[model samples]
Target chain A: MAERVRVRSMMPPGHVRTPAYLRGKVGEIERSLGAFPNPEELAYRQKATARPLYRVRFTMAEVWGAEAENPDDTLDAEIFAHWLIPLDD
Target chain B: MPHDHHDHDDFHHDGMSPSGHPYRADNDTPLTYWQVMEIAIRELLIDKGIATASEIAVQIDTMDARSPADGASVVARAWTDPDFKGRLLQDASAAARELGFDIGALRLIAVENTADIHNVVVCTLCSCYPRNLLGLPPDWYKTRAYRSRVVKEPRRVLAEFGLTLPLSTRVRVHDSTADMRYIVLPARPAGTESLSEEQLAALVTRDSMIGTGLPKSPA
Candidate 1:
């Protein structure tokens, strides 16, 4: 089988399952809860079971742009552990 | 070597459950006798020991708990705190946690609505709903017409729902695909300034959170 997809800090930049609206975006990691199976793997029924999941928070204007009324307010989302890679150059 | 059988037997596209009914399709389809038999076969697996009812029930329970009073608490905190509201607008899942709710395994996105812009969520593939936060998706949400037309012709679709935003109000459509889901946090309606959290939660109906209605005066 494929080598276990490493828990890397480098995230791929492109039209990934990660929302088109959220790519190239910066957000804080509110907390890191451990592994859960990646959705792509689960959907396709890949071998690995649980992988990690994280809750990343972003502002409304950050995602929606100037159209946001209360530009000061923010919104956060729970992303799977595998879905995110740490920010490293 | 004669290849072994890989179990494609259980795999199904999102458009239809294994039984061949469009999993979320609202329009009627006349089933042929053969197709009907195939559906019966698929359902029997569900009915028999192949898949337990408890598994489905577990999925339902997970969905229910994800959106329950925890949802109310998230909205309530937003009403009371500016800094937290700022965080919520920045990152919805984190915001949800601020109110002491853990989303667990489910993924969520908070779509914000404003004076000039309104937001709506649809799953073009299937009813990939925020089952946890919004309760069950309304029937119309799963319809083929709503899914196909919402993105291309939003104003017409909104009008069908008895929602006619000002021509000036820009409507943005968020299409949910696969695991990720969208939830709309509508602007608190005017004249609700003094309402208590319980009263405010009452005004914040599922439809309002989904962008089909606005937070309104208590009936």
Candidate 2:
């Protein structure tokens, strides 16, 4: 049987899900929401298993303008494991 | 209350009117032969039981009612209430649901706009959008060029639409991958402090939320 590659998110500076609007920015990892079979796979009827889901927390100024809002406010976005990759700290 | 027009096919008129216009003439744009084929695929899915007409109708109904009223309420509350805003950033779908909107099976993300940064969305692969909240996307939003190039060079693309952000402004591009989608919450424009929620919603244009245009104030 062919080895199945583990699905992961590559949120690099130049990846698809990592929007140009959020490059070189920083945010906190808020939660680990459950994931299901990847939609891209299911769109083609490709059989798959459940994956991982995450919600990345970012400040409005961190993603957009520094003057976006008060330091207290922030934004959270849910993403799949296939759309994220760990950055070297 | 009047029945939602898109709830049933009884109100879903597919044919051109006497003046060659669809019931909703505002979005009546000409489609090429290929676009017709694209729609056929969705119909095929329904026929095959992979999806259902009712499901698609629900999607349509979701679109019909997605006005700026909901978005404006979210933004205004975010500006005034710290906790509500926190929930918005933490989980947009739940936040929206708390405000009485049905996100239904649609996963969402909230993109907050600040003074110097902007966020824009495009479906580089397909027109994957949060149809439940934002309504059907405009034809221009689903174009091949816009899909292919928006992420690569957003500033230039936005400029073509007369959205020229200053050099100081940062632009973020989000590609709609999977069923996950995004909505832009533009910073409240100046000179609208005295407006009501309805008035604020009027200024919340679909284009602005998609990051193609800026929120406008009453002249």
Per-residue lDDT over A12-55 for candidate 1, one digit per residue giving the tens place of the 0 to 100 score = 55333445445555665655545655665566666746755654
Candidate 2 residues lying further than 4 Å off, grouped into runs, are: A1-34, A44-47, A53-89, B1-59
* Model 1 lDDT tens row, B105-192: 4567676788887887777667877665556777888998987666546667778777887767767666664456777877877877
Q: What are the lDDT scores of the predictions, listed in order? A: 0.63, 0.68
Q: What is the TM-score of chain A alone in each candidate?
A: 0.65, 0.58
For residue B186, give model 2's deviation from the true position in Å: 0.4
DockQ of 1: 0.07
TM-score for every candidate vs. truth? Answer: 0.55, 0.63
Per-residue lDDT of B153 in model 2: 57
